[model samples]
Target: MSTDAKTFLLTGGRAPCTLELARLLYHAGHRVIVAESLRHHLCRFSRAVARNVHVPPPRQDPDGFLSSLAEIVNQEKVNVLIPTCEEVFTLARGSGRFPDHCRVWVEPIERLTPLHNKWTFIQEAGELGLQTPMTWMAASHSKLTEILRNINGKFPIILKPVYSRFAAEVYLLRHPAQPCPALSVSPEKPWIVQEWIDGRQICTYSLAFEGKLIAHCAYRTTFTAGKGSSILFTPIEHPQLLKHVEEWMASKKYTGQFSFDWIETAEGKLYPIECNPRATSGIHCFGESDRLDQAFARPETASLILPQAGVQRMLSLAMWSYGLFSVRSFSQWRNWIKSLLAAQDVVFRWRDPLPFICQFLLLIYFWKQSRRHQISMLEASTYDIEWNGEY
Candidate 1:
């Protein structure tokens, strides 16, 4: 640790991206304090962690939780408050409660609310002239039917909640014959139905300072599910995408870390999915590009440097980690083997392997837990609900 280290308080410590962010900051000689809503996996993986406080769970008592966090920020003399989860609005809205001495990097409340709301985000993007998917909001069964009839949607359409955290309740109606069976469509709680564009999924990671894009990078997701982080990624350059990014930040007056997802259609058109106003899962590619250090050193630095061929090597190392857990299917085993061999070609280096090793262990633990029915994808939200009354 360095003597002149600054402290950063990170929320949602249990998220892997949050832990990785802490590791990057710690390696850059910053003292790390994690204010987590849960102590399970985060407490286990942080090697350079200075302190870990379990705040009131987010969903239960957002207001009280922020108040408690405000007190901690003052006590710890935190230099920056970094939130990694969907509870960003909760913290940003309560920013005034914290002492002015602490700098919380969040968008203004007015902007934060609309940014998190999917429908609002789409409208805002359209207003800003950014290319976004054609989205229609349906609040009732009649509206849903009407929207479906009017659009005459093709076989595959995506149905998602107006305010979704990750891929919760998102479904793909693969064919018209399989019209979305009325599960539950509240008039007040509308759902978004959009043409499911076929294209490669790419995520752009960026940081803004006073509405200016200071740091940016884009990566293609090689393998991803609705909820999990990308298993593989490749860095790429798309100037048009960057153009929309600059316009978006300028329009929103965005400041702080944020990410936007895009789908590059077969026709070479880019359609914006939505914006995540915080750090994203694909940020690991920063380390691979050797630009991770620059983000910590200078917040104003912005560049889109592609990763060297060494990325494959890093993927191989990751695959080796997977193989240690007895990933046995022929295709699965072969993929791991390919990654192990490919890792030899990458230049990205893990400064500290402890956290990565711990992450691998946790992945295996969760996998086993799933097989035993201890946890289900749909039931994951219950964890937040359990603390609802506690706050």
Candidate 2:
């Protein structure tokens, strides 16, 4: 470990991504303090966390969140503020408020808004000479009808909000006669109507600093919690795709962590689908403490790769329990058992036992919110928690 250790303030405590980052920073000899909106969260219980502070939710109370965070930065002498979830929207929106010494590890709100908005992202990608699907933006049902008539693609169009996470409220339409729920798009918020492309899903997590790709890891999601969240991650090499990402980031002069959802057609054409301007679960695939240290700060020494080929990192609890009840089969059961025995659960570290024990509290919280909101268990966990700048 280096003698000059930095103090990091990580936000988004309820996310497993935060726990993974805490472990990485702590092992690299940095003081890992966590600030969270929720009272009970996995990252708060982690032994890696040097301190835990509570704050008002960024989406619900932006001013309060900023004040609380400013106090924490000054008191802790935080060297950096890293947001691990959608709350990055709020943080980026108030980027100028943080203390001079504390660097907020995200792009400016101006850059983030387009990338966070799906409709805007597609347009921006196309303008940048990147491959993007034909997408139409709609602010109302009437506008959607207009787009439908002019669209050049076949049936099975994909519709989703311009800003959302975890694939919430995404819809696939097979025909005009199919019952479609009314979209919530308006002048304030918009929706995306895209040509549904058939291809393999490829996801990448990259850490960029001042337009340079310092470190990155690409992987295929072996299993997913829903249409969006990956439960199991298996890392792979995609040199061309990575190069494309590098050039794209350099062109935009992008900074901070970015996770991209992409589609690769059968002919090997890569089309960027959407961008999440925050950390994702792919960090778990890079398990080395020293490598993470270099990836974030010591970029000169960093060489990023999967810990090993064919290795699996998973949220075992979600995969096992959800797999057993949702879709029971001998093959799936065996795979789940194998994942439990062979793969590393991002939340469960034997050295940090309390967080593993306390994780169940989140499930209970999700369950209560799910019923209260009349949503699915997955949506309940993230619906209110993830602020897409919608409100």
Question: How much is the lDDT of residue 49 in candidate 2?
Answer: 93
Per-model TM values vs. the true structure: 0.81, 0.93
Candidate 1 lDDT over 29-139, as tens digits, reads 788888866545543545757888878876777877888798889898887788777667677667788777677778766767676677888898888876777888988
Q: Tens digits of per-residue lDDT for model 2 on 208-283?
A: 8777787788887556777778888878889887898888888988888999999999999999999998999888
Worst 10 residues of 1 by lDDT: 382-391
| Model 2 lDDT on a 0 to 1 scale | 0.81
Clashes per prediction? 8, 0
| All models, RMSD in angstroms | 4.9, 2.3
lDDT of 2 at 321: 61
| Least well predicted 10-residue stretch by lDDT in candidate 2 | 298-307
Candidate 1 displacement at residue 320 in angstroms = 9.4
